[model samples]
Target: MNINLNINNKIYNLQVDVDEPLLKTLRTLGFKSVKSACETSNCGLCTVLIDDLPHLSCTILSVQCESKKIVTLEGLSEEVKIIGDFIAEEGADQCGFCSSGFIVNVISLKRLYPDIRDELFIKNYLSGNLCRCTGYEGQMRAVRKYLEV
Candidate 1:
């Protein structure tokens, strides 16, 4: 079946199965920035903004995404660049696999809780995402920088 996908403010006609996960469809459609790690949703690598909220693309059915505004890392390139600059300054970006999802998650969190500043809160907030590289210290630094901005 065909579904309407609103991505980065542009609409596209996506022909996909209703049960297909949004992540698969996204990757097939060229949104490769949406990383796929642990398709069970344990890893936040598949995170994407759906209707302005961070939703795990690995678990979300493609049909549910129809007519919804889906924002992937490609769409958030400017924000990711800003975060990347901060990550660079903090010596954070390593492996780069989890960067996209983490950045997207941070963007969503910052928008949702603009006044959040508790380190513990930030740590807990980012607990869902797993990064094998960088050891999370750099990740924390990047998050701190993002909050400052």
Candidate 2:
């Protein structure tokens, strides 16, 4: 199937298998940041913003995303740079494998709830993303700093 995908603010028309996961298609197209740690959607490493909502790319079909506005971390808005900066300053990006997905999801959360500052709420919202390193303390600090700003 030939599908048109608006990814990272650019339009891509590519031929893909009907059942191909969006993660594979994106990666094949050189969007290497869309990691695929867990193909079953258990890990949030494949998360992407589809029409402004975060969705697991590994579990979504390429055909299903035809014509949708898909935003990867590379396409993140400039306004959300604070989140990235905070993460870096806090040294939260361990292994760096999950950073893209974490940052993308954080951008979605911040856009959805600009005034959300509760630690529990942030933790609960980001629970889907699992990072074995850093113990999540640094990531939590980054989120708190970003929200407080």
Candidate 1 Cα outliers beyond 4 Å, as residue runs: none
Instruction: Report lDDT (Cα) of residue 48, candidate 2.
Output: 94
Screening candidate 2 with a backbone cut-off below 3 angstroms (N, C-alpha, C), the clashing residue pairs are none
Work out candidate 2's RMSD over C-alphas.
1.3
Q: Residues 1-149, candidate 2: write the lDDT tens digits.
A: 88899998899999999999999999998889899897998979999999999999999999999889998877875845888889999999878898888988888888899899887898899999989786999998898887777
Task: Tell me how candidate 2 scores on lDDT.
Answer: 0.88
TM-score, every prediction:
0.95, 0.94
**Model 2 TM-score (2 dp):** 0.94
TM-score of the candidate numbered 1? 0.95
Can you tell me which runs of candidate 2 are displaced by over 4 Å?
77-80
Q: Which number leads on TM-score?
A: 1
